[model samples]
Each structure stands twice: as C-alpha cells, then as structure tokens.
Target chain A: MLNLNNLLLQVIRLLLTFVIIFLTLIIFGVSPFDVFESILYGSLGSYSKFIRTLIVWTPLCLSALALIYTFSAGMWNIGIEGQIIMGAVGATFVARSFLGDDLISPYLQILMAMFFGGFWGLICAILKIKGKVHEIFSGLGLDFVASGIVIYLIIGPWKRAGIASTSGTDIFHKASWVPTVGDSNFPIFLIILVLFLYIFSLIIFRYTSLGIRLKATGINTFATNRFNFSSEKYIVFSFLIAGAIAGIAGFSQSSGAYHKLVPSVSGGFGFLSILIVLICSRNIYFTFIVSFLFAALIVGGSQLQIKLGLDHSLIGIIQATFVLSWLVLQKIEIEKITYKQISKMFAK
Target chain B: MILLENTLVTVISLSTPLIIAVIGETISEKGGVINLSAEGTIMICALFGFIGAYETDFAVVGFLCAMVLGAGISFFISYCDINLRMDQIAVGFVLTILCINLSNFLGQDYVRINGPLITKFSIPFLSDIPFFGSVLFNHSLITYLSIVLIPLSWLFLNKTSYGLAIRASGENPSSASSRGINVKRMRLLSCVMGGSLLGLAGASFSLYTKYGWSEGHTTNYGWIVLAIVIFGGWNPFRAAVGAYSFGLLQVLAIKAQSVTLALSQILPLLPFPLMIFILIFIQYINRDEIKNVPKWIVAILGGNQPQSLGKKLPEEIK
Candidate 1:
C-alpha cells in the first residue's frame, strides 16, 4: 500500500511536470503537441540525427552527474560554465602544442585537459575554503575571469590572421579526435559509462556512510559538526568532483565534435544542468534520464528553429519553465511539511 | 597624465549603478530579507526604462517606470518567499532567469531605439571644485542621489525607529516578534524598496549613460552589486567603498589599454580577480560574524551564506 502510494505520487508529479512544459510552450505561442512531435522526429528523423543527439547527450550527462554531487552537499556552484571553458582551453592547449595530429598519444592530452579543468574548479574550492569566500559569488567572479581568458587567447596569443571569427586555436587533425563508433555512429560507450555512474551513485546514496554523513551535514550543519563530521571538507570535495566532471564534459564537447575551440562550447549546459538536477530532485538515476530528455529538447528545439520558425532560445524557455514548475511543486511539498510541524508545535 | 583623469572619470561613472543597487541591497539585508531577484528587476527595468523614455521622451518618466517594474517583480519574489514559503535563494534565482529571458524577449525590438538622457546639474559652489567638479558634480541627479544616500543610510540605520525594528527582525526574529513588530511585513517592504532602488539604477543607466536600451548593457551589475554588498559587510557606507573600488578597476582597465601591451590583453578580467580576492579577504577578516549574520541577508546579497529555512518543529502534537 505504501509502495502504491509512492508510485501514485510519482505519476502525479510527472503529469504536473508535463503540464508545466506544455504551458510554457503555449505561452511562447507554440503548440506543445506539435513541438513534442517535432522533438521525437527531429532526434530520430535520420540515423545521422540520432547520432547527433548522443554526441550532445554524453557531455551533458557527465556535467549533470557532477552537478548532482555538488548540489547534494548544499553547494550551488555556477562556475560550471567557466570550468567547462577552462577544460576546453586546457585541452586545446595540449592538443595544439604537444599532441598535434598524434592519434597514438591523445590519451595523455585528454587526461591533462581533465586535470586542468578540475584544477580550475579546485581554485574555486580553495578560495572558498582558505579564503572564506562564498562558493556562488566566487564561482561567478571566476567565470568572468575565465571568459576574459578565453577572449584574451582569441585576440592575442592564439589569434589567427585568416579566420575573421572570434574562435581561437587551430583545427585538429582527424586522428586527434575521440573515436566515434561505426560510420556516423554516436558514442555508445557513454551509455555504459553513465549507467555505471547511475548505479554507483544509487549505491552510495542508499548505503554508504559518506552519503549519510553528507546528508546529515546538508540537513543540519550544527548537529553534523557536533557529531564530528567536517562539512567543509566534504563540500570542497563535492565541488572538486563536480568540477572534474564538468571539465570532462567540456573536453569531450571540443575534441569529439568541434575540433576547434569556440566560445559557445559549453552552450549554457551549466544552467541546464541546474534545471535537470532540480527536476530529478538530486536523484542520480533520475538525472541521467532527464539529461537525455533535455538533450533531445535541445536537439529537437534547434530543428524547431528551422521547421516551425521558433526562436532557438525556445529550448531555454522550455527548460526554464520546467525548473520553475518543479520549484512550485517542491514549494507545495515544503508548505505541507511545515504546516504539519508548525501546527503541532503551536498546539503544544 | 591626461589618461589618468579619463580613467578616473570612467570608473566613477561606471560604478554609479552598482553603488545605487548595492545600497538598496544593503537596506534589504539589514532588514533581514534577501532579494535574489535584483538581477531580474535590474534587467527588466533597464529594458523598459529605455522603452518608456524613448516613447515618451521623458527621462524622469523612464526612471519612474523602471522603479514600478522592479517593485512589481519584487512583489512576486516576496509573495513566493514569504507567503508561499518557497526557498528564497532558489526562488530568487528562478525569477532572475525569468527576468533575463523576459527582458531579452521584450527588448529585442528596443535595442536600436534611443532614449532621452538625464541632464546633469552641478551644485553651486561645490561644483566649482577643480577635479571633483567634473568627476563628481557633473553627473546626473541619480548619481548624486546615490552618493548622498550612503551617509543618509547610515543615519537611518543608526538613528531611526523603523530602522531599529528592521535590524531587530534580521538579528533575532523571535525577540522582535515578542516586541510587537511585524517581521514578515518589514521584510516585504524592504524587498520592494531594495528592488525599486535597483530598478531606478537600471533606468538611470539608460537615461543618463547608455542613452539607449541594449539587451545586456546592465552587464551583470546585479551580480556585482550583490558582490559589493558582501564586500561592504552589509553596510551602506562599506558597500559604497566596495563599489568605488570596483569602479576604479574598471576605469584603470580602460585607461591602461593605451599604455601597456599585456595589461590591455587581460585588463577586462582584472576587476573579477580583484573582486574575488577582496571577497576572500573580507571573509577571512570576519569569519565569525559572517556565520552569525542571518541567511536572509546573505541571500539578498547573493553571498555564500547557507540557504536557511525556518527551524523545523517537533513531530508530535505539542
């Protein structure tokens, strides 16, 4: 009976979430049903389109996983945007300088790229820990510095005379690229990797001491401290892990497809990750599903730009609407809980 | 030598909006409510402030319209956070995103249109002071209002009755409630007032400086103001200092472009690193007190304070 009740609750929330999505599209003067159809056909339209969604979904999934870790520990790091940028910067720096066209040894470059990205995120964590700065503001400030660094690279050190665009770094040889599966195939390997992450996260969340300790810290820092748990260290570690995952996502986006560094490589994936986390309510397995759904929306929404004359940003609006609705639902749940508790206390 | 004066001027002028916004934020925080929606308020006002002024050709009208827009938006945040009991930080963030997109969508057509600029006036004798006259006295009335508001805020905070009530609510809600104060109402008022000030600042930019509506012309002043509020220690005077310091960095960066090769290369980024370093320094100096300040204040200022909800009650009937 309890299981049935929980299942019913899940179904209601899912239906509410869809209603929110539909309402959001309607507000923008688009039909949700038509857009939904477009999203389905857009991703599965052709073999090539299906492959494209996977390419986008892989990095998005990695970053979402990283975000879930940080958010669960009660840290809101807006620096994923910059972290990803630095990842690409680091990757480009390595691929161009040392591993240019060397397919035999790109693995080392990839590892270095991940390190640099993670290292940048660590800078934010260290600043928060040692310097006492708040994570959100520091992350925001760091993002600006990172943006300036990218622009500086394009205008100064890595400027190309012939290319008029703002993009920096040179194009990589085909050999330096991360290998895709059979001809025009998406990276199916991501499925296996993300699945592993989902299972690992589920196990850790359900059974591990670290998970319990982290939740305790999140719920009540004073009580957690009384129990001798170092909340600060755990939070910093969460940021480090989150930053590393975001870093990998950045490196993947650049090397797997673009082959050249562009400013939009992160493509607002950081903000989207926040939405995915909220919708899934910090559940790792749920995030994997939502991230792919988001990828489909982006992949399909872009097609809407051409087919339905919708703005490219409609995807952002759709995602934002979903997040806002989830928040409303979450708010309702909190209200009910608070009402129950407070009413009882007042009764006493 | 000439470049120094030019840099000085640019910094002072550029820092004006942040100064105005952060001062309002300081008031909101002192009263113990966080207004995370300042970003949205600022952006929407910046967009519509231009539209109103451009259509009507009145700078004052533009400023007034922006304040209304900001206040209206802030009401939603206050309602959500207070009445609906939503997570303040999360609500503010979501509202911020909403305002950004809404402004972007609204301002898409207004980007090319220009608005009337607020005319600058010099105060009689003080306006005659050599360097200070041109740099300080020769700006719009709104800029001058922001300057005067600093000391005025200090007085209001230290010497006023309502101010004390607001501060009390922020410091200890239960104690204040026992004293017969309406804590929620004070918070709602502060949120709206702070939001209005931010809106006015957004309007001032279009009316006095940018002289037109641009989608991103506010350029994260909301975030910067939030940072400055923290850097200011939630005090209006301190926030002014932080604002000016940031202003100085922006000025120096622009001026250094003609003087050095490398400085120009990364000069735009200079303010960010400086802001981060300053924030870290402030946090280090006030670590103990920093933790003690209310969560609402931290949320309002966009600092790294925990997103606090009211304490949970006992499970069984009392």
Candidate 2:
C-alpha cells in the first residue's frame, strides 16, 4: 500500500517540519537538540513513561478516529470538543449515582458517553441541516455551551463538601475508574477498547455500504440524490457516529486519565485530533500513527518544566507549528518541487 | 442618576475593543473572506501589544505592533487563500491554534506585568453636558475612536468608491473583474485593513480596558466578536449595536456575580447560544416562505450576509 517515493516525500516533509520547529525553539532561546532528546527519553525511555504516553494516546487516537467519520461525510464537527465534554458529563452522572459502586458502572459510562456525545453531535447536524448554519460557527457556539454546562456542574450541584471550586468534581467511585491490571497500573481496559474500536472501524469501512455512502455524501451532496438517498441523512449519521466515538474519548479522559470530571474535561485532545486528521485525512492507519506521535509529544511535554526548566506551552507551539507547516507544505507540493529540482540537478 | 451614568460609561468604555474588532471582521467578510483566526489573532496581538508598551513604555507603539501583527496574519491568510489554493477556514483555524500558543509561550515573561495604560481625555465643553457627556465624552482617545469608528466605517463602506469596489469584488469576482477591478488585490487590501483594526482592538483590551498582561488574557472576546459580527448582519452600525449589547451583557454579568457564581459563569457564555439562535433566525427570515415579514423587523433583526462570504474567489483578475 505504500510506495518508496511517497515515503521519501513524507520523510522529507517531516524533516522540514522539524527544522522549522527547531529554528522556532532556538529563537525562543531553547536548544532544539536537547528538547528533542528530552521529549524522546521522556515519552519512551521507560516502561512507565511509555504507559503514560499510551494513556494520552487512547483519547488522541479515539478522537482522530471519530473525526474520520464526520470528515468523510464532509462535516467539520468542530463541536467534537463539546461532544467529548458531554461524554465526561455522562460518565460522571453514572459514577456519582446509586450505581457508583456497581461493577457495571464503567461499562455503563461507555453507553452514556455515547448517548450524550452523539446527542450533542446531533444538535450540530440539526443546526446545519435545518437551521442552515455553518458547522464551524454552530460547532464553535456549542463548544462554549458545553463548557458552560461543565462549569455549572462543577461549581453548583456537584461542588465538594463545604467548598465550591472550578477545580473539578469528586473522584469517581474506584469501581467506576478504568480498571488497571497488577501493580503497574497498566491501562489494559483502555488498550483493549482502542483495539476493538480500531478493528470495528476497519471492518465497517471495508465491508459495509455505510462507509461508501458516507464518503459519497462527503464528495458531493447532490450526487447522492441520483443514488436515491438523502446526503442529509448521512450527514446526520456521520455526526452521530463521530460524536459517539468522540464521547468514548471523553469517557477515557474522565475515567482512565483524571478519574473525575473537570471543567476542561476535553483537555483539547478534540482540537488536537482535528489537526491530526487534517493532515492524515481519511487514512485510518495514518491517523493511528500520527495520534500516537502527538500523544508522545504531549506526554513528554510534561517533563519540560522539571528537566529543562522550559514551560509546557512550548509543546503547544511545536504541535501547532508542525501541523501548520505540514499543511502548507502539502498544499504547495513541496515534495513534487523537490523531486523536480533533484532530477533537474542530476540531469544537469 | 449617577449610578445609571456610571453604568453607561462603563458599558461605553468596555465595549470599545468589541466595536473596533467587529468592524474589522465586517470589512474582511465584506471582501469575501472569513478570518476565523480572530480569536487567536486578538490573543497574540493582545500579548504583543502589552509587550510593546511594557518594553517601550509608549502605548502608541503597542497599538502599532498589534496592528502589524493582525494585518500580517490576515495577509498570510488571504495570500494562502489566493495563491496556494488552500482552504481559508483551515488555514485560519490552524493559525488560531498556533498564534494562541505562540502568545502563551512568548508571553510567559510578560504575564501580570503592568504595561502602559491609555489615559482618559475629556473634552472641556463636552464633558460639562448633562447626560450624553458623562456617558460618552469623558473617555480615553481609543474609546472615542471606537465610538467614531461606528459611523466612520459605515460611511466608508457605504459611500466611498473604494468601498464599492471591494464590495463588488466580494459579491461577484467575475463581474467585478469585468468592471476592471482587481479582485485578488482588493481582497488582500481589505483583509489587511480588517486585520489591523482587529489588532487595534487587541491592544485596546490590554492598554485601555482590561489592562495588564496575563496568560489567556482577552480570552473568548475574539469569538464573541465573531458572534456579534453575525448579529450585526454585515452592516457596521448594526454590528456596533451588537457589540454594545454584549457590553451591556457583560455589565449585567459583573453585577450578577455577587448574587451567585453559577449565574455569573453561565451569563458570559450566553452570547454563543444567542449566536446560534440569531443564525437560525437569520436563516428563517431569509427563507422564501417568509413572504410577509415586516421591513422594520428586517431593518432591526435581518442580517444581509455577504453574497460571497467564506467562498473561494473564482478567477484572478489582473
């Protein structure tokens, strides 16, 4: 499925991205080499660090996968951030209830997260379909609305005993937390879930008409009219599925990562994944790989403060620069230009 | 009477940046480009504005720096939209993320440090007037500029030949090109102009109203400006009204804070939901079925979105 030339071009583009990031860091008085080394060693140097990277990867990858669904249907789904938040809210609702101690609480959180996330996604779809609102603006508005709901929950009815703060809700019941294996606190449950979802997504796209219809809806809204099915229905369908998947990501954040619902429960993974899918597009395998790399970057960024005395905001700068540079480079066909120049040089 | 005067003054002064920024976005949109990076542009510009003032100790330099930064960003977006054939929204979206983080990273040193503040200049005769003076006249130069900008931009866009050329390009590039207009150049010029005002608004936040630099300073204001622009329906006067209404909302929010924290937190986000509702309303009003809608209602609530807002320019006109 891969060609040497494409791989070569990809490598060249990645190197260029790194060069840009490296130069940007030097301008900020940071050593590019040291930063790279630190990030590598911090994320993958040890088993525990790698595990932390995995924790970050679960949601990052899940959101990327979720984005594929909506993107294929030509939907922006920028409200994916809000959908993730609502998913956390859904999980927190179950965890704080009479079922908090039940063994089924974690399982139930998954369903509730899906329901809540899907419902939030449905709102975006409806706004676009009936209200004729652009998904970007509607999604942006819904994101703020979701955050408002989260802040309200944290500071009002869900406030801690004798103190109300925007910090977060009480920790979810231990039983509701994503179950870990042994003394290593390995996130086996989350890993299994990721694997299952990936395989499920592969099968759905490869073997079913749903995938074809969604792609068709994305390619041309009117073209689907000749096929006798409304593209609007597929838009709604993709949004629901995307939102459901993104909700699971939120569930992972609340249960596996933080073990509680915070005001910023989404942790920006939704937005980050949007960037990832922008470059990766509908390539599922690429999404998986890119999300892992981004996860490592994020996980390792936590080390910047302690080891290098650098602020973690540098991580944001690097991620954004990498994505922006990559997008610009791809748009201009830097690889093609480079190849042309190289051949010309050889001929000369 | 004094209480009402104080409230009105606060509302007028506080709404300055929103007023300026909305007009800037309106200018950009009127040229057929949606600069979605408003949130991040204001953020980064706010930081640089504070840095420029804090370092140089001159408020004017800060405003200038932010204006350049904002204009440069819009220039980049327009350039990419025209030459590189990239999606305007995607490019703007990535820039927003990059600019916001870049500000956070670079601004770490400048956070919470007091920068130069804009001084109030009350007109001697105007300030003595009974009601309008207290509410409108006794304010800083930038605030006065914002007030003036409302009508000024309205005139420039409605009456000027340059404004007509830009509007023609936005409405239909092919037709405008046929009329001997350089569509690409007009878009670039208008985007830069709009972006500069956005930068001015960013500096206004730091140097005038919400003074001092901090991480995430001027948060949500950029998005709120976008919402208000839509609420204004592409008319400078209407957009100014939307900005002022938001300022009133913020004033009410501050007062509500003492009553309850939850309400206070929720009130600020009201613009977003209201944005959604207004958009839906606009769509409904624009529908063909609504044949008997009152002209007055259209004047007040009707939003005449740009004919080619957010769409790609078709062919280049030299």
**Top-DockQ candidate index:** 2
All candidates: TM-score? 0.85, 0.96
Native-vs-model 2 lDDT?
0.90
Off by over 4 Å in 2: A1-7, A335-348, B315-318
Candidate 2 local lDDT, residue B78: 96
Clashing pairs in 2: none
Write one digit per residue (lDDT tens) for candidate 2, span B109-192.
Answer: 887877788889998998999999878889999999998999999888889988998898888888998999888999998899
How much of the real interface does each model capture, measured as fnat?
A: 0.51, 0.81
- In order, the Cα lDDT scores of the candidates are 0.73, 0.90
| Interface RMSD score of each model | 2.7, 0.9
Q: Which candidate is the best by TM-score?
A: 2
Please tell me what DockQ candidate 2 reaches: 0.82
The window of 10 residues in a row where model 1 chain B has the poorest summed lDDT is B309-318
